[model samples]
Target chain A: MTGAAARTRALALALAVLTLLPFASHSQFFVNLAMLTAISAALGQAWNIAGGFGGLTSFGHAAFFGLGAYADAILQTRYGLNPWLGLPAAAAFGGGAGWLIGTATFRAGLRGSYFALVTLAFAQAFGVLANSLDITGGGSGILVALHPGAGRFQFTDRRAGYALAVALLALATLAAWRLSVGRFGAHLLAVRENEDAARALGVPAVRVKSAALALSGALTALGGVLYVQSYLYIDPGIAFSAERSVEMLLVAMIGGAGTVLGPLLGALVVHAIADTTRSLITTPGVAPMLYGVVLLLIIGLLPGGVVRIAAVRGDG
Target chain B: MAEAAPLLEVRGLARRFGGLRAVRGLDLDVQAGTIVALIGPNGAGKTTSFAMIAGFVRPDAGSVRFAGRDITGWVPERIAHAGIVRTFQITQPFAGLSVAENIRIGAFLRTRAPAAAMEQARALGSELGLAALLDRPAAALTVAGRKRLELARALAAGPRLLLLDEVMAGLTPTEVNDTVALVRGVRDRGVTILLTEHVMQAVMALADRIHVLAEGALIATGPPRQIAADPRVVEAYLGAGAAARLADG
Candidate 1:
């Protein structure tokens, strides 16, 4: 077997082992942590599509995530719709929001820091709107009643939720892999590297970027749907928080932004640190402070992220 | 007398930046299956004219017709899809990708399958004498290597009309000879080429027709021998007492 194939096999084995881990552990806290890690990994992967590959670093992914969470929460609470149906609806909402953002910004030729700031403003606006709206249960947030059935998108045991989260992560990772190996991914990377050159070579720069943003938004919305289903409650603060946006970008960057498994590895390290700090400290900001220090060290020492370090060691 | 319609036609193409007119009412034509050279001194708007023809720059007036269809003001990708592709004056390969991958992105314009694109990239690499460097990152290439990669990438797009901007600006004498042959080979393959060049030897050796631009407008257009003897061309580009120097060089 070639080195890449062997590496892929090893990764598959590791993921398989992780998916079966909840069965061996009786601790609900461990399962919950594992689920959170998987969800964050998926979210990071979604962001990587546009931010890493297409070179559109968005600081407002929370808009899509919040839209997804609200789509599910509102439909479930008011319309009594199944969460399975809500998934596609949430994805559509996210994609539509992405279309709007991409069209408005790209048409106006807003790029780089301007594009990032505009996206941030959009997320902030969505948060404020969600907070003021009565349909979103005002600032206090909306609660998802515990139906406790697979049909209701709720599981009686933590194992099912863990399984679902792992599955979603697997799906997201597969999608990222497919994109990285295909024509669309090449176009996106070309646009990222040099938009004018790409367009001169017949790759439609605006269309490629807009498509990437739409796909990313839809996938991120799926992550949001998973989050609300697992937690059974969500407020505008939790759903559309700037911290959530930062966390997603940080996880992807820490892992290696454009790589297939970078986000997953990043999520493991980040969530593990958060879980360990929570267990050891009563302080409110200690975990985030540590995260900042680690990020600084990573950026200073290994700008390519932890994946590059692993690749170098593997070569040795 | 009415002549055959040129593959690319530009008329009254103008552009301005504030008070400075970059390219003013430039009219140029390139017939099918020929290597045409656009020659000028520095700041003669050769690059700007190339950009306008390739749809990179919007013209203030006039139209560009490709295969007799108006393509003025079209987006670069749309114009490229209509079979007009361009290379940058400064090479712009995707530095992070391998040389083969950089070419493969261009090949993707013709094929959707990754395998097919890779095959096309390899063929182009071999054709351009860059097969050995295919797996190396583009950033690792020399200046001449980057220039070759740019040409290879443009070729990989399967262009009917190629607008080359300063492709042979920096190269050794031997490399220039090799590029002269390569340009001939490309023209032999039925791809019409419109190139801006400063290398007199390559232009004299390769160009079937030469067009001279002076101050954003065409000053002379003819066969190489006529262009070389044209006093107007000499005064505009070759300078005083430099015509014999150009001939000697």
Candidate 2:
């Protein structure tokens, strides 16, 4: 294998081995934290597919997250449907929303900051709709009853949830890695660099961007479903908040935007900082304040992300 | 000479940007396996005409046909897939990607497999004297290198009709000579070329037929020697000193 490929495999194997720690730990608190980290990494990876690789920087991915959470939570609470069936339903809903949003905005030739604002607008609109909708439980949100079984997609133990989160992260990383090395990935980057040039070379730019958005939306929705299941509840404020969208972008950017494993690394570092600051500061927003500083520092010092530094060093 | 049907046909291709008529009533044809030159003064609508033909610019009124098929108003990607590809006047390599990767993007137009694309990129790099620099990032290349990389990328798409816009614009004389030979070599390999050039020497050396445009209108079309002797062509380029300049030459 090539050196870079070998290094990637080794790193993946090491991370897989580390996922076993939550299972071995007796403390549920630590296991839960680990699960949260894994979920964040998965979400960040989803954002990376669209924002990083496809070069469509969205500032409103919470729309998909909220949609997935609401789709699953509402179905289980209102109609008494199985969570298993709701998962696919939520994914489809998210993908459909992605297709709709992508097609409309891209077809209209909205790019750069305009595209970002449109996405943000969509998320805010969805959040407002969720707040007033009766079926969604309105501003109070929906609560899913505990089925407490593997068949019901609910786990009795935190370790099992951690395992599922880790599995999701692994699958997301694998997908990103496969895409990074393939023709589709090349097309995505080409379109990102110069859309007109890529089009001249026979890449269907709009179609590629739409596909990326759909895949990213579905994966992010899956993360939302996991989040809802873990918490047993979801509100529009929690699921569709602008802060949630920024958090995903921060995680991806902090680790490495376009690299496959950057999101995981970013999630780990961001969570660690948040955890460390929470212990020292009692202020409600102290952790996020510190995160902003760290993001600024990272952008100023290592704009390519921490992963690129390692790549450069490895190459040297 | 008996002639096969033209590989590309443009009829009444025109475009206007607000009050500026960039191109008006431009008609062009490219015969199979021939190198056609579109020459004009700056702002004579040469680039706009090329853009309209390549499907990048939406012509205000025009029809573009390729290989006997009507392809007017098609998108750039669809036009490329129909065997036409174009390079920009300013080289636009993916700055973050390695040279091989930049070319590989074009190679992917013909192949679905990444390995095959990479192989094609490598082969094209070697053919274009860029084999040693394939691993280098495109951002680091010199202007001449970027221009060659741009050509290599367009060639990687396996185009039957290649539209080159100012491919020799900023090159030194030696580089222009080399590029002139390279462009002729491309035409010799069965690809029809439509090019716009400012270099009269290169145009004379390479073009099978020349078309002159002034103020977005075609003024003359003929063999290089015939064009050099034509009064309208000379007057269009040299203003009123055509006969004197012709005598001086």
Candidate 3:
């Protein structure tokens, strides 16, 4: 079989194994780490669609993540909507946010570092809005009710969070797989490589990038839904925090930017390092500082990410 | 009716960058199935004229008609979608992608299926003498290989009109001869061609007719023999002595 087909089968097998994780007798801390890893993978995959494949590098994915969290929490608390409905609702809010930001930046011909900075600024702005907004409960944040059942998307068994996280990772991984094999994905990559050449080839550069960001935003937002459901609470500081954006980027960058499983591998590595550092050092800000050093090291030593070492054939 | 309008028509097309008139009042027509050449000295605005026709640069004050459709001010993607595509003077292949993937991107202009696009890309690559190198990254290719890859990519789009910009800028004589034949084969496929080249031999060998420009204005337009004999065209290149030297050597 071709590399892509082999990779697909491997992905299916990995997901199958992850699906059974909840049934194992793992400690709660291990389960939490597993859940966090999967969440990071999903978020990384979502970002990779735009930044890795489409070359719409963003530093503000926390905007969509926070939007989804608030959307799900507010819908359940104020509007009496099911947590299940929040999936689509949160995705819409994320997609709309993408559309709003993409239209403004792309139309003005922003690209490269400028585009990255704009995303960072947008994330910070959203964080401020969430901090002050009353509907989001201001600085205090909001909480989901303690309703435990599959119907409510909440579970009494805490291990269920890992299972749900795996499901999200599968969805995002499938998205990356589809992107690698699709014509639109080819066009998006071409645009990423050279916009003028892509335009000359009949690829609508701006529209393709905008669409990529919207799809990525929607997918990233799904992780937000899972977050509130798992923790039963979310504050702007946690939801729209700049660190959340950094972790998403860190995961994708460390794994492999454009490959199908890059983010998954990256998430596992990043989370493992994070948890190890947290345990080793009780001092505040030390773990994040290490992350910064690691990011710089990765950028300097292995620009292609950790997955490149494992790739037997070209990722494309 | 009157010979169905030319595949491309440019009338009074002009562009200026500050005080420098990059291209001005440029008028040209390319008939269907014909390979037309636009030759000029350095700074004669040949590349700028191609950009205007291909919609990379909007003309300062003029119109562009392609197959009878006035396409003035249209974006590059829109113009390409309308069946007109241009190759870059400085080859802009996706450097990290394989030659097949680069051509496949052009093939995607017509089809949405990855299999179909790859099939087309494969066929086009072989036809352009790039079959052996299809699996190699574009960056690894030599100048001649990149030039051929550019041609194959543009052809894969199934363009009705192709604007070839300096496809043979730097090449040995044998490579130039091969490219000339390839371009002729392309015209046989019924795609109209408009090319800008400094390579006089290729221009003389391939162009059905030649248009000579000097300082953003057409100095002469005729068959290759007639264009060679024009004193103004010779003057534009330099003195008669240098012109003869360039034409022969």
Candidate with best TM-score: 2
Worst 10 residues of 2 chain B by lDDT: B1-10
Using TM-score as the yardstick, the better of models 2 and 3 is 2
Runs of candidate 2 with Cα error greater than 4 angstroms are A1-10, A283-287, B240-249
Q: Candidate 3 at residue B16, lDDT? A: 96
Task: Give me the displacement of residue A297 in model 1, in angstroms.
Answer: 1.3
The digit string of per-residue lDDT tens for model 3 on A1-316 reads 2775576567657756765765595688777777888899999999988988887889999999999999999999999999999999999999989988888899899999999999999888888888898999988999887999999999877688887888788888888889898998998889998889889999998888988899899988999999999989999899888889988887898988987778887887787777777788889998879866876787687788877655644356
> lDDT score, residue B177, model 3?
91
Q: Which candidate number would show the highest DockQ if scored against the true structure? A: 2
Model 2 has a clash total of 0
TM-score of candidate 2 to 2 decimals: 0.97
lDDT of candidate 1 at residue A157, scale 0 to 100? 78
Cα lDDT of all candidates, in order? 0.88, 0.89, 0.88
DockQ of each: 0.86, 0.90, 0.82
* Residue B233 of model 2, lDDT score: 79
True contacts kept of each: 0.84, 0.87, 0.82
| Residue A149 lDDT, candidate 3, scale 0-100 | 91
Summing lDDT over every window of 10 consecutive residues in candidate 1 chain A, give the lowest-scoring window: A307-316
Which runs of model 1 end up more than 4 angstroms from their true locations? Answer: A1-5, A281-287, A313-316, B238-249
lDDT tens per residue, model 1, B28-137: 88999988999989999999899988888899999999998999999999998899989999999898888999999889988889999999999999889999999888
